[model samples]
Target: MRLIEKVWFNSHPAKYLLVPLLLPLSGLFWLLSTLRRLSFKVGLARSVKLTKPVIVVGNIGVGGNGKTPVVIYLVELSRSLGLTPGVISRGYGGQAPHYPYLVTAESTAVEAGDEPVLIQQRCQVAVAVGSDRIASAELLIAQGCDIIISDDGLQHYRLERDLELIVVDGQRLFGNGLLLPAGPLREGQWRLSTSDLVIYNGKKAKKNANQPLTMTLAATEVANVQSGQCIKLLDFIKLNPSVNAIAGIGAPQRFFDTLKTNKFNVKKQQSFVDHHSFTLADFSDFDDTIALIMTEKDAVKCQGFCQSHWWYLPVDATFSDVDRALLTDKIKALL
Candidate 1:
């Protein structure tokens, strides 16, 4: 883990001593972030309102909070209601030849961002990626998408959104509650109140007047990264109790925990930084005979040199029927 990431995700008594040292920088970040929002709010910087409603799925914290799963869920929900949904992402850790890279199942993670490509493959929806989200949204609009879902751009004030869905990691809910280098928060904790909805990824909702909806990442199946063969997670665990688990996501422990939940004995676990580019050399030390399990997101980047032993676990974000109805009704209201 990187130094900042260790402090950001993990809490220690030393953090209280070290966090104060970074407060000045965090304060400056807060000022700049606040001013940027004010620029749009005061009309100094204009926000473009698209013809279709845009639902933004994002988090105030820096690392993963399972926003992509939420986005996928929204897309599926939209389709059930006869609305075609498109996705736009900032394309983090990806660089394209040009702007507005449209994603397809065949699109490489290098060309389209990993999450966008994953979404395209899984949801089979129109997905576009670029730093300029408006341009990406325009491409989706041209592709006959009725609703636009911006992934991980809650603070992109330039793109006016009808609904803001903020995802919070139930375990690491706003660590330290400070901004930037000092803590995990991208914006102040108060930002939650301005959001249309708050979804807690994992853990049950805390009882409060405005209780946030809860969702859990449920393992669905395991697929061979090279051949596309799939098996039930339970069956996979039964067949191979001792396996090497790998994750290249922002929250690697979450993936490891899921494997444990399914009774898989993860004999060896490796964690790479978020969106780390993988090479065959990275796995040279691993025994090719042993089963290697990875997250679906990481599976995209390793397909070129993946072995038959390599497999990935695919998971779905599951919510209660009542919560699903509430979220669906909220989106329909925007339509």
Candidate 2:
């Protein structure tokens, strides 16, 4: 059933008879979403207040929109400013959402989920997962955390938030432009107008979408998981001009494209579903392959069994000057 949601949401084509049924059904879903939003807006459903500020980074579209990297960027920037930040996630594919569980160095990708493990590796901050996002936020607060950065809770109204940053996949803005069962939007497109900030992390922004935040891929380097060997983009290109790559992300092609821009000739690019929890069996047949490289998000789930040949590429998000100032200012206000 859960698997069906992923497929159905991604490719819900419209038909005439389905229109009558879907129109009303989408209307109902919209109404419920609207009522839920109104409830929070009007205080019918009170939002939780914490000693620290909660900054939520998420997308309106169902699938990923650079959520993890945005969260990582937030954490990194906050830490440089001397704030002790804690992270919270729904743990989309983990085993412990039934209870509030901490993400630690010892936590496996299976237990803590792939994204959380990646966050733990990148941020080294306190992390936890639970269905009750508010509870997960509170747990982080209890750990002496003063600032909370939620990975993806744009629609989780129950959790409450101080700052709302909507991450948009510029390439696929509001696909089909209809609500669920009709299109990709979880709510109406107008939802973006209300967000405190809109981040366009892709190649371009939507028409007339101003004050837009843009990003360019920074340097790319490969790090050997087992031996801790770090190689520059040039070195990897020099060593092996061509290699096989795998990416289980919202946009696998981005990584592949980045590799190509760096002058490497990639032969095969295997893309899996986002937040993919990799299993050893997935790579069983690809044994002795030294040139397999993937993003850090995918690498976390594949770390323990990562062979000397397997490497992870690290890249950073580069924002424009105006956008960077706006982002930093909004986040700083949380204090």
Candidate 3:
């Protein structure tokens, strides 16, 4: 992790000096964000409500709280409920040819962003990417979608939402509990109460009054990045007792820890900044004999140039029966 992130998430001594230095900037960020939200509330800024109900799955913190997997789970749940769901994302780290690009079988991560492509490929749903989420929602509506799911836009007040689901990194819940620059949060902890539902990624918060739901990312299988062959995670571990792991997600340590939990002998692990564009040169030094494993998100960006030994573990968001029923009932009510 970078020095700033270490101070944000970890209990580093640098926070005593670094946080004080960045407090002014954090105050400014809070002021601007508050004003922007107030603008929408008071009609200075327009907030568009789409024809279909829009569910926003996001977090207050800057890093990944396993929102993508939860999004995929929602898409599948919507399908099971006989509703067609579509996703809209900001397409961070991707410069598409135009606005509101629809993800297709041929769409590359470079064009549609990694998470959008991954969702489209996994759920076979209508996924759109652009800065203008309203335009993206219109595109999905044109495609006959009955419901809209915003991948990560809780703070995007301009696009009005029917339901807001905030995912929290339960283990690292709002480090320092301060705003950006000084902490990892984009908004304050109070934002959680304003949200419709709070989903804990790993564990539920002890003192939360919202009666939050908890979800766990369960590893299902490992697949070759180059080929389409897949095998059970344990089977792959049996074949390759020791492997090298790499992750480019916001919380790379979570991916590494998942591997360890699955009993994989991780020989060496590497982490990169979130949404990092991978190249063949990035893996030049890895020993080809031992398997190289990565998160499914990273695999999406590396598939075109991946070696035969490169593999990726795919995880699914699993929730308890009561939580699933409650979530389903909430969605039904919204519909």
Q: Please give the TM-score that candidate 3 achieves against the real structure.
A: 0.98
**TM-score attained by model 2:** 0.88
Q: What lDDT would each prediction earn against the true structure?
A: 0.88, 0.78, 0.91
Clashing pairs in 2: none
> Over 4 Å off in model 1, which ranges?
13-17, 207-211
Model 3: runs farther than 4 Å from truth? none
TM-score of each: 0.97, 0.88, 0.98
Tens digit of per-residue lDDT, candidate 2, span 1-335: 13333333344343434545666777888889989889998989987877789999888877756778888888888887888999998887889635688998888778988888889877789998988888888888999999999998899987768998888876656766778765567876677777787788766665545345776657667887667688888887799877778888866767787778878677777788788778878776553554887888888888777777788888777787887788888878877
Tell me the lDDT of model 1 at 60. 90
Superposed model 2: Cα runs more than 4 Å off: 1-25, 206-211, 284-290
Candidate 1 lDDT over 49-78, as tens digits, reads 998899999999986789999999999999
Backbone clashes, candidate 3: 0
